[model samples]
Target: MMTRAYIFLNGVGEKEEFYKKLDFKNSSVYCADGGYRQCLKAGAIPKEVWGDFDSVSDSEFKDLEDSDIILRKFSKEKDSTDGELLIEYVSSKNYDEIYVLCGLGGRLDHELTNINLLFKYKNINIKTEKELLFSVDRKYTFINKKNKIISFVPFSDEVRNMNLKGFKYPLNDYLLKRGDSRCMSNIVCSDEATVDFNTGRLLCILND
Candidate 1:
């Protein structure tokens, strides 16, 4: 059995409803600051609530005073953001994979930051209502993604010797440079589409 971890970020109320459909039964769940309220609203309790508590309301803090959930508080003046710190902690636990929920559709900076984290943590992925974001360095295959829309962006200066098999727009030993949109909005043509690259990282986005 592959171990999994879920981290919830602070998102708008509209996103709270999406949480209800998530299956967290066998996964470790954690919240970053204000995300605790959203997690609770979804009828799910996190194992720990981590952050500086700047975004959490006083009333909310009071509610957690006697709760069994662990609180990992840090200084507001810390160099790293709450999300980054929480991710580091989760990555250290040696889980097979980590899914970050509600990480998108928030502040633009935070959204980009979450995407950037993909390069640092090989097993971390950003999951939103409409998209799944992950990073691939060597080879990756998409199963049951036939005809689904997907895109690949070069996360480094340039992606070398990239090859795409079973896609609408196929690439053969192509070099994808940064800021390139040539590979955007491609459709998977087979049941299993493959992405291979010799060097550099590629950010893969599966749009729903």
Candidate 2:
């Protein structure tokens, strides 16, 4: 079984209804500053909350004063974003997988930063109601997902020696370069599909 961690971010209004339906009972949950509001709205309590509190109002902070949840406060002039801090903290604890909720559909810069983190930490995945985003290093397999819209986005200059199996448009050891549209919008044709590469990383995005 995989040990999972759920990290909540501030930008969740776009898929608020979908996020509210998530069950955080089995996994460890953490909130980043204003993300605590989202966690509460989802009827889940966070194990810890880490941030500078810049995005959280004073009243909100005061309400958690008597709570047992661990609060790690930082300076407003910090080096990292609130989300980064929470991710690092959870990553250090050796969680098998980290699912970032409500990290997408926010400010463009922040959204890109969250996506970039996937390259650094392969165990991290940003999930929304309609899409699942993660990094694929050497190889990745999709199980029990037939006819799903899957896209392999090249993160490096070139994803070399790639082999796509069980796809609508399969590739045999092909070089997928950046800005190439060959790997986009492909559908999974088998219950177990796979993408293999010799070198470089790819962002594997799956749409439901």
| 1-208: candidate 2 lDDT, tens digit per residue | 8788899998754345785566678889999998898888777889999899888888889877778999999999978899998888788889888889888876889899988988876488888888989998798888999999998899889989999999999999899998888999999999999999999879989996
Per-residue lDDT of 38-114 in model 1, one digit per residue for the tens?
Answer: 67776777999999999899988988877888999999999988988999899899999898876776688887887
Instruction: Give all candidate RMSDs, comma-separated.
Output: 1.5, 1.5
Backbone clashes in model 1, listed as residue pairs? none
In candidate 1, position 63 carries an lDDT of 81
Task: Please count the clashing residue pairs in each candidate, in the order shown.
Answer: 0, 0
Worst 10 residues of 2 by lDDT: 12-21
In terms of lDDT, model 2 sits at 0.87
The local distance difference test score of each candidate is 0.87, 0.87
